[model samples]
Target: MDESLSHNDEAHASSSHSGSRRGGWITFPFITGALVGLTLAAGGWLSNLIVFLIEEFHVKSIDAAQIANVVNGSSSFFPIIGAIVADSLFGSFSVISISSCISLLGIIVLALTAMLNSLRPQPCVVGSELCQPTSTLQDAVLYTGIALASIGLGGTRYTLATMGANQFDKPKNQASFFNWYFFTLYSTTAVALTVIVYIEDNAGWRWGFGLCVLTNIIGLAVFLSGTRFYNIDKPQGSPFVGLARVAVAAFQKRKLQLSSESKDYYDGHDGVKEGIVTGTLSNSFRFLNRAAQKIEGDIRSDGSIAKPWRLSTMQQVEDFKTIIRILPLWSTTIFLSTPLGVQSSMIVLQALSMDRHIGPHFKMPSGSVIVIVLLSTAISLTLIDRFLCPVWQKLTGRSPTPLQRIGLGHVLNVLSMALSALVESKRLKLAKANHLQPVVPMLALWLFPQLVLAGIGEAFHFPGQVALYYQEFPVSLRSTSTAMISLVIGIAFYLSTGVINLVQRVTGWLPNDINNGKLDNVYWMLVVVGVLNFGYYLVCAKLYKYRNVKGADVNSGSADSEK
Candidate 1:
């Protein structure tokens, strides 16, 4: 196989997929990437599983955020580094391999800390009357464990996904490949969430955390197993450099060119899912990065012009300007984010209180609801997307685009949140009526609509936006572009927490007490979140620009790389 032919052969390949399965050695990358992704999720789940324990040990929410930030940041950090090393020294495959190892070590250490915690004398929970709280010691150990886990998880998350994307070429197969890529990502998450959460819920915290270690080992094994047939990327400088250079030029208001790569460079765009029209400047985020001088650069041959691409339309420039201007509106989705987020927080509280009954003799485990996560998501997507969507297409004469899917999800999100709030409201009324506990058996069932809605919502929302990002952003900013899109969810997570707290404070829902008092107000609050999320969706719908930029379509045949 002529090495140069790597370009010509793949140049024609679609960004979406390739039929070439690595029958021999190539399986290494595939298995490695998937394992990394699953392991990362498993590790993050462990952190969630034991977060209350940390709080029990008196670990403050600030400390918990530090630990979580480490894990979450990995999703962004590694790819930027990997993209650099990949374009410069080690390829994406190598970066992924290295990241997996790093993350594995982190999980191992975290597991060890858990073992130590089980043996240590834990501190008492704050505000205790008679009972001693063990949260202090638990908090110390969790802090250490989560710290290491975060670095590892963050590095792994970024490397694996970027590497996975590197596996496929673009243009012809771009769409289909993304569909499968997205399918696997969510499916893998669904599977991990279901099985792992149960262990955390039932098997004890130590084993639950240890499971991430198992996943890491599995991922390493899979990467090793597949050695041949992987599509390798040509090494370049840090993607950050390209982004930086492009950004500076965009603002100085100049024409854009590769300026870095010669014949050796190939343009790759990850946002193949965004359905923006060709020749349109609809990538608002990328444009902002340019103006900010962070993610600016040209996807063309080496040049000295030192200016950003002077896109023809000021309207397009304004489109980006418009989107950035409207970011605060999208930011409002954080409120809806708050309700959905209680899954690990208040929802878990509810889950614990539920009648853990499953079989005739066996009690349902606390974490068992996670099993429902995947099961419900798969069923709904297949039923709604595959069956219902096609029927709708026949009726409306159009297939559901990513945007349409988003709209549907927003609608579902409203309903899901409302259902949760209603259940909480009922729990309050039932408490008042019967002088009973605030946590109801029916609340567990009520969560069904919410969780199922979330899964369905993600299936459409994240993947759709990811597809859009790749299709629209300049090739240089592709990986970073996707990361930013992903960052929104994280931002939403933080914002949601704040909003929930604020509402609870204003309504006096905190310190939920002995009977059915404190939590009922909490339920009504979530109801409001659902309504607001629907409105945010509407706002985004009105302002978003739709553009589809193909790799080949945007390709400027210029040569600059000397190496």
Candidate 2:
């Protein structure tokens, strides 16, 4: 009787533990999502401000792009590192807390700079010069503050998003949740991109950045305070080491086989059961672990390698190679980002060159108009996600497909760029002919194309596709994989600047000069790139297949938000 009672007690305890473990995963999506929304809002605000500042401050667009790109790169670049840290050691909560604080400090600097700028006022100059020829020392301070904040923002980009998605554990439910989760991110942007920008531009750029800083502070506080609400996963160990191991296994497959002489993988009368390595989970997991060991052993043994197949996991994670497998499909994202990024650079320049004085009584800040458009996007996103997504699912018997949303957005990106280019081209001709700024900033009205089309595209594309990428990455590599996709956008910004500089070098064209700012040509360049990206996606559509990792393993039901 005593033995039977003990067995019953043990069974009950096991059941309770199993129940707790199962329930824990549901929180993953919410946690990662909150962080993603916060970071994306900051991204939109920064992208908007950077453009206006360059024009208003009379700096070159290429220079401004480079500065903003620096922060953009960081915000994107750090995700792989954060993913590795999160997957292996720190866990999601610690990673988010640390990264959010880093970003928060950067925002504080910007807020201070904004507060300082409020002291100097010169509205009279607003209507006269197309751009500020010189900024007070305080202006430089503002730029630096914004840049630092962008860096902080970039670092947390991937980590929090990944962490949030990890909470939902059911494959089917996880699938539905992912769609909803992405919707939240884009919807929030529609709000931030529009409302935040409008307030900042109408009030003051400093005030705009200052508000962002305050918002970030609130985000940080909310995140930290809600720490207890999070589903803290068990820390696996150094995710970098794990990734390295997988790379090693992949690279050293032949070597390992030769050394084992096919003996390591036992071929028994009952069939085959491969020898598993330590610190590895499943078959693929072990293969990776074993590969890492073999690679390390080879490195130690040979002392030299020709063509050196050793992959730098860091760069591999961010550069073309790691993501190249998916690039053909993801090419669409590149097209979408160009117009999205332009909301800051060329767009703002066009606004500056136009007649910004509206109706004698109102001098519209070009950047402010762009902000309103973005805020409108946020509202639209909310309506669509909350209402449209559900209603569409009921009517169509399917939700918004990632590919459809992505393709639609790409189309919109092109339209926005094309419209803006035309408006800008006309404004330039008018200004040049009159020997004065155009009667009205046509660019203001042209912003509608970007505001409306771009907003709609983002509502569908940004969140939908990003959620897909996160879902597709392997458990250990989830964060790193997501970072890989995001880095492309960041890299593209840097690349755009380089490309512009290269064009300037080859043709001896100065950027932002009235003659060179004949951006109709550059807009054409974007059009060509956008079309090519669209073509790339078509190719991917044929070869790519969606993987819902959650369906495969209860451990990561929230892993891939696949169709």
Q: Please give me the total number of clashing residue pairs in predicted model 2.
A: 18
TM-score of model number 1? 0.71
Alpha-carbon local distance difference test for all models: 0.51, 0.55
What digit string (tens of lDDT, one per residue) describes model 2 on residues 266-332? 1122221223122212232233323323233243343332222442222222222233455566655
Cα RMSD (angstroms) for every candidate in the order listed: 8.8, 8.4
Best by lDDT: 2
| Candidate 1 lowest-lDDT run of ten | 554-563
Candidate 1 lDDT by residue in tens digits, 349-429: 555445556555755444455555556655665566557656877998755555565566566666666666666666556
